[model samples]
Target: MLILGCMVLIAGCGCLGLWFAYRIRRRPQELRECSMALALLDTEIVWGATPLPEAFGILKERTDVPWQGFFGELKERLSQGESAGIAWKETMIAQNSHFCLKSEDWNVIGDVGKGLGRSDRTEQHKQIELVQRQLMVIKEQAETWSGKQAKMWSYLGFLGGIAGVLILI
Candidate 1:
């Protein structure tokens, strides 16, 4: 019974570790999803020339949490007549808990906040392109780290579990 219990405990630890590793790998994909959504938002702003609130409204419908919460919050803020810069910064801060993006990643996107809806279409387009490029870069780096780290974490978890079980015996 003691041996069986040790086995179970070790298995549980391994599962927990695997979950952590999965999250590590998944973070990059989540960022990519956000990046794609931003790209779509850019197109809407460029071609549709919609108001910020409405543009965000359109984006909110198509996304899940984080992005959904993100666009929805922006729409609400903009609809309430808040300035785009303030609204954006606040919303970006608010969404941090809902997302896995690092602070620098948030800062990268946050930098583009003030430019939204504050400029001529040409300037807005330029800022959007710049933001898109930055996001793509982040996405690339995330993919690279996740690719290598995914296996490393899994092995670390597995080995740690085995070590723990041996220690118990």
Candidate 2:
């Protein structure tokens, strides 16, 4: 029973490490998806001449999770009479913990919120493009870090679990 308990504990710790690794690996993908979602928003707003709420509603339908949820929340907030910037900030604040994105990424996103519905279509397009560029750079950095650190985290987790088991024994 003692050995069994130790084994289970080690396995659980190892799984926790794997979860961390997975999160790291997912960060770059999430950033890239965010950039793409911004491009979609740009299209909806600039080319299609859609209103902020309607554009966000379109984004909510077309994007993936986190983004899908983000856009949906933004749409709902826009309906509640909040400005785009405030709604965006609140949404980011509320959902920040659930995402793998860092503060800088959120800042980049915040820029978009600040610009939304504040300027003409051309200016909005420029702001969205700037954000997309920033996100691409951040995504590249995240990819590099993920490639190196993801494996490290997984290994460290497993080793830490082994160390804990040894200490317990």
Clashing pairs in 2: none
Question: Per-residue error at 138 for model 2, in Å?
Answer: 0.4
Model 2, range 2-64, lDDT digits (tens) per residue?
988888888988999999999999899999989988999999888999999999999999888
Measured against the true structure, the TM-scores of the candidates, in listed sequence, are 0.91, 0.97
lDDT of 1 by residue, 48-110 (tens): 888888889989998777689899999999999999999999998887887777788888888
Model 2 stretches astray by more than 4 angstroms: none
* TM-score between model 2 and native: 0.97
Candidate 1 Cα errors over 4 Å, as ranges: none
lDDT of 1: 0.83
Q: Which structure among the candidates has the greatest TM-score?
A: 2
Give Cα-based local distance difference scores for all models: 0.83, 0.91
